[model samples]
Target chain A: MTALASLTNHQVRLAQRLVGAPTRDNWSFTTEPVQEPAEGGVLVKTLALSLDPAMRGWMNEGKSYIPPVGIGEVMRAGGIGRVVASKNPAFAVGDTVSGGLGVQEYLLIPQDQINRNGLFRIDLRAGSLTQWLNVLGMPGMTGYFGLMDVGQPKPGETVVISGAAGAVGQTVGQIARIKGCRVVGIAGGQAKCDWVVKELGFDACIDYKAGDVKAGLKEHCPKGVDVYFDNVGGEILDAVLARLARGARIIICGAISQYNNTTPVQGPKNYLSLLVNRARMEGIVVFDYADRYPVAVAEMAGYLKDGRMKSREDVVAGGVAAFPEALAKLFTGENFGKLVLQVASE
Target chain B: MTALASLTNHQVRLAQRLVGAPTRDNWSFTTEPVQEPAEGGVLVKTLALSLDPAMRGWMNEGKSYIPPVGIGEVMRAGGIGRVVASKNPAFAVGDTVSGGLGVQEYLLIPQDQINRNGLFRIDLRAGSLTQWLNVLGMPGMTGYFGLMDVGQPKPGETVVISGAAGAVGQTVGQIARIKGCRVVGIAGGQAKCDWVVKELGFDACIDYKAGDVKAGLKEHCPKGVDVYFDNVGGEILDAVLARLARGARIIICGAISQYNNTTPVQGPKNYLSLLVNRARMEGIVVFDYADRYPVAVAEMAGYLKDGRMKSREDVVAGGVAAFPEALAKLFTGENFGKLVLQVASE
Candidate 1:
């Protein structure tokens, strides 16, 4: 058990409110003696951490789907871990779990915090620890429901997605392909674009960092975008809005591009296209579909088993202190797939 | 008919393409001898001309629901008239008709242009000539289907509408009230706001020109906006978006405020609220629901007959020569209720 009696916890806490893109100055790294678990509490040893764009939004002080992380508090994160010690009957030693485990070496989930924080056991036989945080986790569930329900992509229809190399975007493109759609992906850099097309089986991938998005969309989607699954909103969102086919469905999953903006978020100026084409733009939060996760997991597991879907995790070798730099990789387009920080080896 | 044998037509023609708002210099007034209707054609004397915000869009060169008005051509408009002469079996000399009669005193609709231009007989017993151009015409049809089909307001829910004093807004607010929704209207001035609430029976009206719209929405719709029928768009659309309830519906009928903007259209900055609240924003064109107009008109007529609804038309006394000046009144917010120019007394 790695001598839990002498364990010391290393944590990254919010030191200052971020103004724009997060820097090292915005965080504080500290070490403290590990506290004993309270009665009925469970202590989890962090194995891996998920680095996401949503973490940027959680750093800002404003109204969002969830509350902002306050200064001096541990930064919130989604991760996989092994229960090292447990005083609760619901959990036991050596049981693997996944939840909002914060960016820390060890997460001591007091009894009262377990339910609200969503701690649950995961089967290692189903997938690797990194895959659970990728395709079988939040990103996977987000793409499954958002594309199938909100996008409603019909067979033979054209589906274009922004941020196609990111975790959610990768899942969305592959799922749309399985649903019999002509999937086009918009990603940064030539490598990411090639990976999405060659590896993920997308029809075409637009390298937005290299050329014009409007021109690329015209060349690839001659029939126009019937469904646009947007993850990186901003000018890209406006560009897609301009090319919407009649009755197009735009699913607003996230706006990673605007998350680090010092100025006001740039809204899509071409939204009037919705009126001209009789289209709709809607938004979705994955947490809203928590009850249906099992159904999506089962379907995705089948796709994985049959080699119809592929999942990739870019695992950065570092402990808990690597969170800030790992998160920066998302905005810089350096992360090629689902980015995960290895807090410790299994 | 008053001296039909010696009838001369006064017409307003587009002299130059408008850059932003239409100035008098952009139009030319001319007089010409009325031409005889061709074989299977119908000649009509204009009774009342409907002045609309959509005229601004038609002046610009672009693809829309209809084609743009060409230079030196008569300005497009919808009006009620008496069929003075006809060669087709579908119409008689005394038949009262409604169609795109243009900004002219007399309209000679040739055979081939009849169906495409929408020449149809209207019952005088159902409404006054001005009322037909207001409550029983395009604006009413827009409000009926847009609010019912797109907005889909449930009883006791809050429905907020922009451009509350305009032709479509007044109808939308009243219909929402009839559907048992708590209706709030946003207009430019106190007088127009008062008329919407006191005359049209809207639950509340916010004078957008006088104060903050966000504060007004908070004061009126404490439960958050369930349906937002956006006619003005721009900042008002953003304000209403910030107050959307879970599963809210935003019906984008028009963007009157942005129609004349010299700058690019301002998209709703708070559109992410749609994601936070799991809401939808959709666009509707009234022309799409042409086949269902009869059902809407019958139901609206019943509301008028029982005194459950009221119709108001701000009739400006002038012929086609006043077309430019009358349209200017709409952008200036100088006209109250549905602005209709009286080409001639009925």
Candidate 2:
């Protein structure tokens, strides 16, 4: 073990429950003396943390896939880290790992907490630390199973994805293209849309911020949408619902647009089109596919190596305190791709 | 035909388009000389007409599964009629047939129109004319296929349905019960709810008009809803959405609640529950299952014969002129079972 240093652990705690879009006041910066790992325990120093739209949902007080982060608790997050010290046989000093380390500088996971918190080793030679938090991480696994298992895209079918420049959407578009499908993406602005089409290789990208998404779909998807991977649900969902072809499959991955609304989320008014078109819309959560992660990761890793799949991580330079403001960038469409906050160098 | 009876054909025609619900003024009554069957044609006298909630959708001028009923044309209707004369080999005199006969005293269907109009012979020995328009007709077919094919209810699961007392709902409730599932229903009034539970053998029925459907679902479906067959969409659909169990299936059969709405239809605000529950919501139109109608009809008919399924028809006593007023009964919930108009007695 390295010599003991005079270091204090910093964490961003939830100060108040959010009513709408989160502000700086919602977080409380706190510091405490770093504690040594007890017997059968591991101490991990977070290198990079993932900021996701689902984090907004975790702030609300309600029943969800996972429990809400309680007041005065460290905010929950998924990140890449390196084990600084370990008293457990499963991990050794300097081993790169990934887990829900929260928005904190150090995580001291006891033996009893390891199973529940999930700590797994990763080979840094295969991908960078940021890549594990992005493509080989939760969002990539989400896009993989959601598009394949739920959307069930086939060759020559037209697949349209909302939130096209976001983490899951970019991965979904590229995967659909690799499977030989016509892909269209709906993103916020021209720059994001251009990046999706030019770099991500999506066949067409609709700039939803510019004008009517319905018209853009009409122009781009002349045959109508066959598979729709919905990440941002709202009017865009309704617009896509209106243009669905017969037997279309809709995969509900997330709903970023409805996350910040103080009012109730708007449902798709044109949902009746599902009846007219004999279509189906189903919801998916990545955690449900945990058992098959190995298969997905192996397939996606092969694609990454061949340059068939590209991952862009918008890594912001900051520690734990920047979490709240960095999270807000997702809602504003400021982040170009997978949003990540660098807590420390690898 | 048989001395060419001295009769003037009485008909109800569309006077104007409906803004909300159809009223008396939306129809125009007229009489004309009944024409004889031309070459390769059939002449039939309308006996009883099926008054359905779908009539409201047909009155609107827009794209749908079928073309809208045009102004100055006889209002479209489905009915069982006796063939008075025929120049086509497919039909014979005195043969009882079912098809889109429209609201009229007489129908002069040309041979070229026979295939498009879908005129088929019905065996009176199997069921009554009212039963042909009720249990053995479109609504029965709608319920059978919608619940079995779309809902795919498994044994030991809990199933919930809206429009419990109406044509489709009643059949759906009974079929789900026969499938060995715990069935719950939602109806407009206390009487309808009581009848659904008592006569239809549903486990419970929620009176949506009396109180909150959400509370009723929470109380009745403690294990949560596994299959929800939605007939009356709107708030009821949203309420059912909230109580869905993991892997729930929501079958969109009809939206009778939103049929008369001049404003936009209220979408299910809690549709995100589909995500949390990993559920699916799909739409079904009965016409799409036309090829398999005989299989569904035979099974449903057997259930009816064995006293496992019951048929109820709320037949109004009047001729073609009563069409407008009889149609409004569906929207107002005045018709307890299958609403039908008696043009002439069988």
lDDT of 1 at B169: 90
Please provide, for model 1 over B126-145, each residue's C-alpha lDDT reduced to its tens digit, 9 standing for 90 to 100: 77788788878999999989
Number of clashing pairs per prediction, in order? 0, 0
- Clash pairs for candidate 1: none
| Model 1, docking class | high
RMSD of 2: 1.6
Model 2 stretches with alpha carbons more than 4 Å out: A2-6
lDDT of 2 at B167: 92
> Model 1 chain B: which ten-residue window has the lowest total lDDT?
B1-10
> Please, what is the TM-score per model?
0.96, 0.97
All DockQ scores:
0.80, 0.82
TM-score of chain B of 1: 0.97
* Deviation from native of the Cα of residue A94 in model 2, angstroms: 2.3
lDDT of 2 by residue, B192-287 (tens): 998989888999999988998999999999999999999888999999999999999999887989999999988889999999999999998888
Q: Best DockQ goes to which candidate?
A: 2
Clashing pairs in 2: none
